[model samples]
Target chain A: MTTNHTNHRTNSSGPPLIQCRRLTKTYKKGDNTITPLQELDLDVPTGDFLALMGPSGSGKTTLLNLIAGIDRPSGGNLIIGGTDISTLSRSKLADWRSVNVGYVFQLYNLVPVLTAYENVELPLLLHSMSAKDRHEKVQTAMQLVGIADRHDHYPRQLSGGQEQRVAIARAIVTDPTIIVGDEPTGDLDQESAQAIMDLMVQLCEDLGKTLIIVTHDAKSAAYAKRTLHLEKGRLIEAAVLAARRAPLVPQEA
Target chain B: MRLLPFAYAVRNLGRSPSRLFLSVAGAAMVVLLILVAGGFVNGMSRALRATGGEHNVILMGAGSEESVERSEIEAGVPGVLAASVAGVRTRAGVAYVSPEVHVMLPVRVGAAARTTTQSSGEQAAAAQGSNTASMSKPKGRQVMMRGVTPTAALVHESVSLTEGRWPVSGADEVLVGRMAATVLGVAEIDVQVGKAVMIDGRPWEVVGRFSAPGTVVEAEVWLPLADLMTATKRETISCVVLTLDPYNEETGEGADFGDIAAFTKTRPDLELVPMTEREYYGKLANFFGPIKIVAWVTAGLIAVGGLFGGLNTMYAAFASRIRELGTLQSIGYRRLAIVWSMIQESTLATAAGGLIACAVGVFMLDGLAVRFSMGAFGLMIDETVIGLGLLTGLALGVVGALPPAIRCLKPTIPVALKAV
Candidate 1:
């Protein structure tokens, strides 16, 4: 079956910011050659908020990592903003990711040694800007996530939800073209997870930033504009759930 | 590539205080070992190098140039050199010539109440025949004994009497070097002025103390030329040490070393070889090359052991931060940048240790006396040795951090992010 995303496309303001044609990823796990993704085609338009859902070993996070430019595709093309980052050199891809992609993690991976404000200012260090400019950008991002008062607190000092807020600030400080999250709310409590999902939705709706998140929680996936499911390294064509009521108690990986 | 903040590297070092301590201690030990080795080698080399006076020459029997102790030259050689060598240095019409006896003999420290020391069992065995055997037998250590006359001071210009008067001929008196205590395997106080030490089984009053700083002669025991000859019961002298004046171009008022060599050559009956004092001691330095190599090898091996310990510590350090490393990479940091930051962190710790080692070396180890076969010399922990130690510490930092950094960074970002 083919992926028909006419109804799933949330923003039609411009061409697709990310496109994957027959993308594949494989690795050797001991004697077994394991493929997590294969020949998958998908398109994510500008300002689109998409959620990828799957059980364990289904490649949802793998897809997110490729889109985040943190991993390379072994086969096919991964074009983001008209550039096939799959072919870029390791160093060039790092440069591209710095300017064009910001990523959040399931565990809210802020550097523990750094304070909240310093963590938020991290991605901005890659840019050639004055310290004053970086400070301003960091402050704005912190305020946007409503955690400006906790700027000096380290990740260990903040709660799970507050850590995620600081992480979101870090992702948005660069004003990148795409933001990807892998199980962003997987480690939070129910209320904290809801709060993190709300902040992420606000990021997409207000800033018009392209967002893709991999989640095992149906409640979290419901917050996205489009949701896709995968099984056995292939996308399930029938599970194109968009802004619909997801099943309660999603299977945990 | 954009670099990580120095604060990140600095702060990481404080994460585990125990690990930080271990790293610092390892570096300190490595650097301290290097300092010790450098001190030993430098002290020995300097002592040998400085013992030779630039304008001084030695007249030894031709077949015994290797060791002055075994050389037997005619007692009249000094007079023959003064009369034949036109460029010989002189003051008040007396030629600068010293007839000397060089011998190594068992010596006893007979000072009262001198008991335990950094004592050697072999020395105690050699001192078994002490006259008052029970309490007075501290130890008998072999010491270089030099017999020199009053004219000997003119030829050896570095020597100066620090206390008491010089030993006159046939007075059964001896002068001790500043490091004579170390050579005799006794405390510094044991060899003080007015004490008597047993040389060749006879008590000789220590009438004076002299120091030729940084030279091998500072370890020798000196007595009058006539006294040493009588005690050893040998008529011939060991060698004649003499000084030559640099010759003038136009007036030719003084002589060169070649003038002395030409005199020795003209008289086949003399059976003597003319060697500059510098050449003799310089050859001694070369003979001790193996000891220097052993010191360096010992230091290197210990450093390698420290490096391995540091490697294990650093590997555990960087390994625990695998996920953090992944997070940094995902935030657009290149792997090389992360490695650079890790090296910075490691180097800062080790450089601190190196600084501590240098301070200790300067304050505690510099000019510390050590006894050896020839005599004794002070450990020379000068600027050069300290510099070598610091460089060693810096190298430890860089070399220690590299493998662990690379290994921790080997995994892909996705794989690393999954690390526990």
Candidate 2:
């Protein structure tokens, strides 16, 4: 099938919050060179809920990671807000990530030893703030995610949906510029996945958060305003703005 | 920049009970070996240092300076040295000089027989008791036997009779040091005052018990010089010990080694070499240098084994948390911070173990007797040894955990998030 692989830019009314121009990521496995992402160009507008979707071995998660500043691009520029993050040193990037990005994982990768409240408060420790300020932020994040009652419970003591809620709380606690989730609902059930997706949607609509998530589930991607499909490290298709809140099908590229 | 909470690192240790146990136990074993090695060397060195007094000199045969037991000089050298050396201390018209005979001999307490003895001694043992042979297998512990006169107390002031009185000459009586039984491989009750100890195929009464505190002479058996000379059939004495007046530089009222050396040169016919007691024992201590090296090497190798054990445990621990570590990094915690947290966890476990080892050293290993050719000395588990033990344990934790922590944190966030 002939498909259009486009270098996407913002279609929103305002300037984009993230700009990726000719982004490339390559690594060596034994003797062969593997490029998980190659010359990928994308723009995410502010207050946008974007979802990245693709098959296994596609670069959806790779793109999410690159935007989150946890991984660097081998070629091209990644400018988030204003600074070119790809040029920043590793430690500097970490400082930027603390202030700018919050990442949620598929399995709700909360430290097993810490309580739900401590897990939510983890990122805030990187910032210099009074105990009262950190406590208030953590309380607000947990209450917003509706997991304030389970703050004292550890990961093992909580159910899967509750753990995911705590993870979402942790993601939003820092009030970062961008929140990235790599298969955030991949390990949850249908009801829990729907609840998590609803919470994420509220984060964008009410809090004006810019969220980029990588998911393989069509139902999960339906919550986002737009969804981009990647194939072999390239963008093959992108859904329209404010895509229907149902199982999404790709629009004609 | 930002660090994980101390509570976080501490709580991580309780995740796997078996791994924690392995880490703590391995650290304890390594630390214990280090403490033992340190104590042994410290005790040996202290014993040698205490055996020599700087103000005393030993005049032995010129060629036999290496060992007092091998040295032989004319019996009249003590009287001549006392008169010729102006620096020899004297009080009440008697010089602080002692002509002595030194020998290594077997000591049989009660019915027990010494392992190193002639066939006649064995026959004597057979006549004493049928169980003598069984008791004789001390493995092999021999003691230094020193022959001394009444004037010996004047120069060797550190020796003091703790129980009973000095041995009466010509009566086959002997004065035993407090540690004599330990060096003779016998029960303490067997060598108490009024008991009999067979030496040189004759029964000698243990009339007195003496102690020289930390010195090596505390392990010797002292008898009358005349009796020892007649029993060994020796025509010459082993050496003459002279206590010189303490050298005072400001007043020039005391004498130094040069004064003693001049006296030796005036009469080369005696073929005597003058050595400070400190130098003599220092040479003996140097003779055991290789043994100390072997001790440290063995400790180091075992410490390596403990390190590997620690590495294996930590690797397994961090392996299970690979995804969690990735999550932390994604939370904007730097790699160095994560590594630091891991080291904190490891050091806590090892530090606990180090404390246990140090406690054991203080309460049990301290002052434990160790036998050597010179005599027996107690293992000195002093502050320095304990300090070294604690430091080594900390180093073990830091060095052992670094590789595993770095390896676990190697996977990129995308790859790590996918780890099952």
Candidate 3:
């Protein structure tokens, strides 16, 4: 058995922070099978802004979850940050995801009882951080998201855009390398949606973080540096574009 | 992971204020019922046991251990045999032995309206007449009258003279218990200071009024042993109280009362029985045992029903929040954490109910007296009953919360995420 040093070098050179090689996932529905990912191959380089666009049953969210290690693929390998996530135990996978990926949902799933600062401090509680450090990190995250003034407000007391900004602060408070969003603006009006998308863009480009977003809105899709279009569980189009393709219209903002 | 979910649980409960109020009210009612029933039973038992004085030793006829009131022994036999018994303590070289007769008779107040036609003023006049006439007649309204020797008071420490003094030796004087005096409307008669009472058409002077340590004696009338015998026309004593030296000391040989009663059979002329005072009252109180049993059984059944009602309320409340639980799961709380939060929420609600029940019991039921056997014992809300209520509340909370938490935790991420 000869040691392959060249193969090792190649693996080290192309070490995508998140790599999905021919990943597939299927669902069973009353004796019929629905394939959500069909041999899907994708590589998310470190600090890249990628958008996923497709119709309702087009597997965009499924691919995002695979990259975020929220779900396992039935076939092929999922490598995120030099570790095979598919091979990790469920608990270990959760720990890995907590450190590596932060999620922002469309509905802004804030615990309704907690104040904005407390909600943002949730992820850090899983670590060994002191209370003072947690408080500082939460304050800084809220300040960065421009919702520091509303730190004591509950989710129900905040507006749509403000709540979404709180959710963004929660996702980034732990300072994870990658952020995954599932239709982050799906429930918002044009103005709130543009504001949320703009926040995501700034988090990725200015903060030097990777972002993977799943959306159907072309306006939201246009904010990313790359857009992958999926159809019938397969990637049909992949395009690389400028990070700021165009400024959102003032009226929408 | 922290108490975060507890806050959420509390807020969710408060979200629908009416439902929360109804659930808490139902639990409180059940707890209150449990506490009241427990207090009643405890009061009854205390009343019964309180009748036995610490220094008293009851002596019954040998063949009839069950009924001290029905037992008969020759009056001379007690004084003679009591001197021979070992462990018989003496205060001044005289053993504290008292042969007594116990009898029950119906008693009514003299002030009970004599006729329907009498006006309140005329009724008062009639009541005064009846009270005066009662002094001359031997028996007016009847009551349970105990016939005791002067030494009886020495054996039973509970007997205390509230006015006047104990009857003189060989006198036809009687001492009425304080409660009997109140019930008979003769509290101011200077009962033991020679006021007269009638028994069997023979007037007997009251020499004193006494209060016993407990409620039982408060319902009795005490008279001289000879007068009670003549009034009732009974020749035999019902029972005897014998004082014994401490078991550890040696005043004489330790004679078993049971063996002495057996020894008397050889004479063929006398019958005797022997037992401790505690054992005698233990039998006398048997009638109340079944009542207590039935009370506990009924309370337990009602408690079971309340538990199920509580469980159903929690299940329904949690069922409506499945989407919220799923959201929590997606937000990275472990299933165990969610379960713990649910349990904490249910416990908080049930504990609130328990506390309310205790408050209601203390406010509405404490010190409320109920008459039984012509005596009254105040309802006692003890610590043990309160402890049982709290334990039941915690059990209800845990049992109620488990099913819904398990249901919430079972589904996969996709299914949970899709719950909305």
Q: Considering every candidate listed, which one attains the maximal DockQ?
A: 2
Task: Score candidate 1 by lDDT.
Answer: 0.89
Candidate 1, residues A117-147, lDDT tens digits: the string is 9999989989999999999999999999999
Off by over 4 Å in 1: A1-13, A239-253, B110-139
Fnat, one value per model: 0.69, 0.88, 0.08
**Model 1 reaches what TM-score against the true structure?**
0.93
Whole-structure CA lDDT of model 3: 0.73
C-alpha lDDT values of all predictions? 0.89, 0.87, 0.73
lDDT of 1 by residue, B231-296 (tens): 999999999988888889999688888788888888979999989999999999999999999999
lDDT of 3 by residue, A1-253 (tens): 1111111112336677787777888878899999988887777788888899877888889888877776778887888888988898766766777688788888888877688887888777767778898899999999988998997899999998999999899889888899999999999999999988988898888788999999999999999977877766777632212323455667864
Native-to-model Cα distance after best TM-score fit, residue B160 in candidate 1, in Å: 1.5
Maximum-lDDT candidate: 1
TM-score of decoy 2: 0.92
lDDT of 2 by residue, B22-77 (tens): 89889999999999999999989888988887689999998999999999999988
Q: Which stretches of candidate 2 lie over 4 Å from their true place?
A: A1-7, A238-253, B114-140, B247-253
Give each model a TM-score: 0.93, 0.92, 0.78
* Chain A TM-score of prediction number 2: 0.91
Question: Candidate 3, TM-score vs. the true structure?
Answer: 0.78
